[model samples]
Target: MLSRSSFLAVIATIAATNVVAAPFTYVNERFGTVCTFPDDIFTDRQPEPDNGDGQQWLSADGASLICSGILNIDDDTPKGFVAAEKASSEPGYKVTYSKASKDWAVLSGLKDGNIFYERRLFGRDGVIRTVWIEYPPAAKSKYDPLVGAIAGSLKAR
Candidate 1:
């Protein structure tokens, strides 16, 4: 038998849990894209930066990072995948996963002891939307779920 105050406390806890799990959208009209992120846990790395290219963000603890942009290249997802592959082919990058579809390209790898995940979505309007999230391998358990949520929330509008 729960007392009235105890029942109210339980309700409050549930409400807070729901709010903390809610996603927030990072929108850039210039890029014609929107990405979902965790609430109040990430801070914009470039709050006043130009939206022409994209936006960058950092975890509140600075242990993780995220960024997204739209490039002006007139190409399809294959081209974007090639570009991503080229970019990740740099000195210390070791690809852990890669996949390409008609509309999406993903390249994830471990570099310099850090984990990096990148995805590119091809828009029919000749715009390439790219997103990147990075965190130390040691922090993957904490950051992976949040990053995954953000990646899963990306959409072209």
Candidate 2:
């Protein structure tokens, strides 16, 4: 048998471990569209920086309609796009990258219907930003936490 305090401790541990907060939306920018999110995270980069693999860039035209607006990825930084993706719910690698930066973000009509969303941070020098993409599409749902952190750090213009 456990003492009252011990029992409470066990319950507290379980509760603490299970507790989860909802995901937040971040600043999203486009032609004339802009939005904000607080729970999300954002980070600053050198404009020309490398996450790990490919050199990150502001590119033009890709699967993501986002490129049509302010930023673009040239030779996309390795797993940079995953900033918009979450951990593998299915079974796969922790992260993957384009053999090339051509496909910054993609929504393959593979599953049934596909949807995408994004947020951007603006600046005077250029445009520092964070973008997220989703399927059923939402803030915390399938969104990447790393991206959320990066988004949280964004300095809006």
lDDT by residue for model 1 (116-147), tens: 88777787777777778888777766666555
lDDT of 2 by residue, 1-157 (tens): 2334533443343334343322222223333222222221222112422322111212121222121134343433324544434444543323333221323232221122334344343433343343444333333332333233322333332
lDDT of 1: 0.64
- The C-alpha stretches of model 1 lying farther than 4 A from their native spots are 1-22, 72-76, 79-88
Among all windows of 10 consecutive residues in model 2, the one with the lowest summed lDDT is 53-62
Q: Which candidate is the best by TM-score?
A: 1
Model 2 alpha-carbon miss at residue 129, Å: 0.9
lDDT for residue 33 in candidate 2, whole number 0-100: 21
**TM-scores for every predicted model:** 0.73, 0.24
